[model samples]
Target: MSGSSARFSGSTHLLCCLGAVSSTIVIAMPAGALARQAASPPTLNDPSFDAALPPLDSAAPQPAAPPVPVAPRAPAPDPELIQPLEPIGSADTTPPAPTAEQAGTGDATLRIRYETTVTGLAGFKTDAIEGDLGRQFRALSALIKDGNKAANAAQVKARADEDVQLAQRIMKAAGYYDGIASSTIDLVPGQPGVVRVTLSATPGPRYVLNTITVTGAPPEPTKIARDSLGLKAGQPVDAALIEGSEANVSLQLPQFGYPFAKLGDRDIALDDTVHNADYVLPIDAGAKSRFRNIQTTGDPVFTVSHLNVFPRYKPGDVYDSRLVEDIRQALVATSLFSTVSVEPVKTGVINPDGTEAVDLLVRQTKGPWHSLAATAGYSTGQGATATGSYTWRNLFSPEGALILTAVAGTQEQGGSVTFRRSDAGQRDRTFQTVLAIDNNRYAAYKADTADLSVSLSRTSTPIWQKRWTWSLGAEIVGTNEAGAALTLGGAQPRITYLVGAIPLLLGYDRSDSLLNPTKGFRITAKLSPETSLKGGKVSPYARTLLLATGYYPISPSLVLAARGQVGSIFGTSVDDLAPSRRLYSGGGGSVRGYGYQQLGPKDANNNPIGGRDQTEFAIEARYRFGNYGIVPFIDGGRVGESSTPGLSGMRYGAGIGGRFYTNFGPLRVDVATPIARKPGESVIALYIGIGQAF
Candidate 1:
């Protein structure tokens, strides 16, 4: 019984060992559901086991009994087969393993420090990434992991290279590359990619003018110094100034008769070391020649004696073309010729002394040409009007013009004749005589006046480009008046006053153009005091008037203009003063927005009341079109005691007008509407005239 127990124990131990091995395999290997197959009863089979009991020799050491096979293995399991499969345990599952490189030398606690340098960034505000270094590093690491280290480095390098190039370009653009600092870039390595770059700039060079010299035989060197040569010491150097100065010198030479003079050998040099520039100019005053004689031949209407009066050159006089021009002007001034010419005669030497003499020639236009013209138009105030004029141009010679005009109308009925003669060598100086008589009703007042005056007047040109003109004249004026109270019904007496005054006029005109002044200013001052020498009242009354106007071009074709006029009578009795001396404002020339003579104070009959002292203002906007124009305007004015015209005293009106261009000038037609009027007053009044209101 003891031996039986031992055998059983051995069998149990073998089964336990087998179980342990199975458990290990199950833990390490994959598992799945088991499949069942039909089982056959085991045949106590293997002959090898059955015949394995062989006798041992006495000399052979006895071996330990082998553990009894657990239920005797039926057949060794097929090498490819797994028996009794079971489910896998969680402990045996794990992720795929990493490669050797990623393990990083197998050092678990390694520390990496990284540095970064960025380049080729435009407007790289530090605030944009003040604390974002980690993000940049992560992006770089990803690039390495994606096997694009070389490509990414190239992209970074490209940007940095572009920035470097841009820096150079910017320096050159500013003209400072020669003085500024250079730039560079480099790369650094760490846990993340890094780079370093530097940019530096320096100041550029400055240039100064070292010398400036003028070399030319300028006309009247003193005058040239005063008019040209706008240079000074210690001024900034400029190449343009050299050219400008040369041109100025050339301009002055011609006025002095050196037409062939010219500037030559001009240059400007720049030196870097001294930071200076120099200018040099040379002038050549070629050959000089003088006019020896002058002669002319043409269709002549005047005799040789008449022609001799207009010679440009005289014996033993210096030759000057300007003098020839003066002589032409003199002949034209006589108003006796239509055309004139002066030519240099090269006649053979007279008296065998090589001295040349010249002959003068004069031409006069055919006379007896006459023109008679009449114009008719309608106006609200005048109802209807017609005017006739007769002109005798070049009556006896080209320089003579005679004019006769007559007007018959409900507002104005008058006639006049005038003859004028211009002087030689002068543009505005003229000798004129006039005989005029006018009978008209002006501003509800009636007056008949006659005047005969002879005068010589000269006009001076602008001063300092201020556009002011000065005129001085001497004249004798005579006057007579009748029907002074015919319209006022004896309220004002029928007084006849004759007086004379020596007048001096000062005028300024700043209009952009004489034909159409859209911008600038115009001012006129006239003072005429009576003198006893003319056998008139030394009434101690003097007249002074001032008128000013201003214009502004608001647009290419539109202009805004305004004007003001003020006048006062002093040193004379009101009765002795001529009606023409009376101050009147609201008229065609004064203001178009109001009816002619309809502005200012009114009379008891609701008609316009004229005044001796007047003030007026007007504003208008003019718009121009294809050879035509239109204007919308406003007018305001007052006439009464210069100081006491009260706020309610002024007259106001608004109107619009159209213009048409003619050979003579622009013709104007306008209609004005009064803003405030008495009961039964007309709503509008009309005016017709020529030229701008101002």
Candidate 2:
């Protein structure tokens, strides 16, 4: 009761203060202020009131400013610095979008980026299948080579599907007919935007031939053809081998008297259980024939009768393609035709041996039969020389030729007319007659000579090299030559000599090439017997020479070659023989750094006197690099005073040469210096010519 009475007394005191403040506010306001406020009030539609406040729809839409583009991320890093991601087939296989770095920047950006991987291959088969798959896909894949211009993910899948078929075909070609090939498009992790195309193959046991059969032929002929195909029962059944072997059967049948033989479609039976294939080759062994008459057509370089000489087989001989090839080669050797073909044509005439007679159709297109040629050579002592010739080949037809030749040189000049008949009376034989005159000026002698010679020989040409060759020739000459005086103080006189000579040469060559020999050896022997009439006295003399050359190949590009020559003269005094007829050595083809004919005896004034005998030797190392070659050579030779060649007084020269090889021949340039410099010999000698210096 006391707390309630104290609270009421406090409340009554606060109420009395508020009632006094309320009576003062009523008294302080101007009279009628509340009435005036109620009479003039602001309205909701007033412009001034609305202008002072923001609109209630302030959150509504508004025009936007242009956006700022984000720059592409910088190129990731050097590709080499980045390790290759593991194959997607293994662990993480989720494909990531290609980054700017993976896809390439700017215009070089690939529509699709991927790498090719071949899996499940073994042995030699791996390389083969991989190579084949690479070739096929690179040429045909829309992904790898970007073969499809606008390539995309869909195209990548499509290409992988097509590759499966292509890989299977390749497996079959490699003799795995039961192999299964599959392809997968895999996403490589870490290599963003790049895909991996994995080609996997399970090559079943390689198919092999279980049986080989020849159809449409007799037992004897079938055996012959089957053996020619070179297919064995245990050999792999490769498509390439089968196709090639089938072609071989047709070719070989013609060689075995089946002139009209041909091959038909092949039949193959695959046995999956044993992985074996039974191959049947159907050969159309047309008529077995014998060679009958050979008919000639087209431009005739040789008459029909003359052409018969080329064939190794005569009429009525069994049809052998080899013989046909031989005849064709013989004609080609003549260099008379641009096009040559020899084919068998059925004559509808049957032989008694149940073989038909076939005539050969020989066709030819004539090639150029006339030519003009020129050659140039230079030697230190011999000076420079140029020779030109015009030849009318086949002037009389059947390989008869007429040639006019002229030689112009610093120390010599000559002209000649020659008539040469090739294949004269026999194949590889030639008959030639030459009429010439020459004037020679040299340190050894000065001579003006007239010569008439006839020769029959079988010599090697650039195209054909005969193992055995021989030459028989006769020559008559009238020469006026100057020589040293008989006495030391006497006058040097010019003597007129008449000479008649018979020469015989025999040669055997086992070398690989005539002009550019790389292996084997060659040997040649020459003997010339001469009768000379000088100062009203007749003298008989014989000159002999022997030459041998050998070549050894140390490597495919290097050859070691050596040659030796020995010559002698007998049955004549040195004073009685003409200087031009004496044996001599030195200069380009002999002792290199020495003057021509300057290696023998000398006169009182130190002029060369030539020699009665001579010996020469040269060795070279020929090394080749592509179209060029280099040769380091050494040459040694001596000219002797006696009738027989001796090793004493030999002069040696060493040289290095460079060769520029062309389709026609090697162009040669050599620089040499005498090993022991002589009084009058040059310190250095340079020789330029064509062909190897042999």
Which structure among the candidates has the greatest lDDT?
Answer: 2
Q: What residue pairs are clashing in model 2?
A: 98-193
After superposing all C-alphas onto the true structure, candidate 2 shows an RMSD in angstroms of 25.4
Give the residue spans of candidate 2 off by over 4 A.
1-122, 126-170, 179-204, 483-493
Model 1 misses residue 253 by how many Å? 9.4
| Cα lDDT of model 2 by residue, 376-456, tens digit | 999988899999999998998778899999999999999999999998978889999999989998877888999999999
**TM-score for all predictions?**
0.49, 0.75
Scored by CA lDDT, what does every candidate get?
0.54, 0.81
* Prediction 2 TM-score vs. true: 0.75
* Candidate 1 residue lDDT tens string, 1-694: 1111111111011011111112244456668979999899888878888777666554578799999877855887786686655567635667556446437636322222122333333331111133322232224332223332233445544444444443433332222223333344455554244444454433244334566665665444434533565655444343334346556776665444334556666554545555455555556653332444334455554445444545545555433446666666665544344566554433444423333333333334533357788886656655566889997765545245688989888777878787755332344444556777777665545667676766565543221133656555444444343323434444544445555666678887767665457788889998776542223344546667788989898998898988887777655444445555555555566654455565555555555545567777888888889779898888887776443233447778788989886655567787777777656445776766655656
Runs in model 1 deviating more than 4 A are 1-287, 290-295, 299-388, 391-402, 424-427, 459-493, 510-512, 531-540, 572-581, 643-648
Q: How many Å off is the CA of 608 in candidate 2? A: 3.3
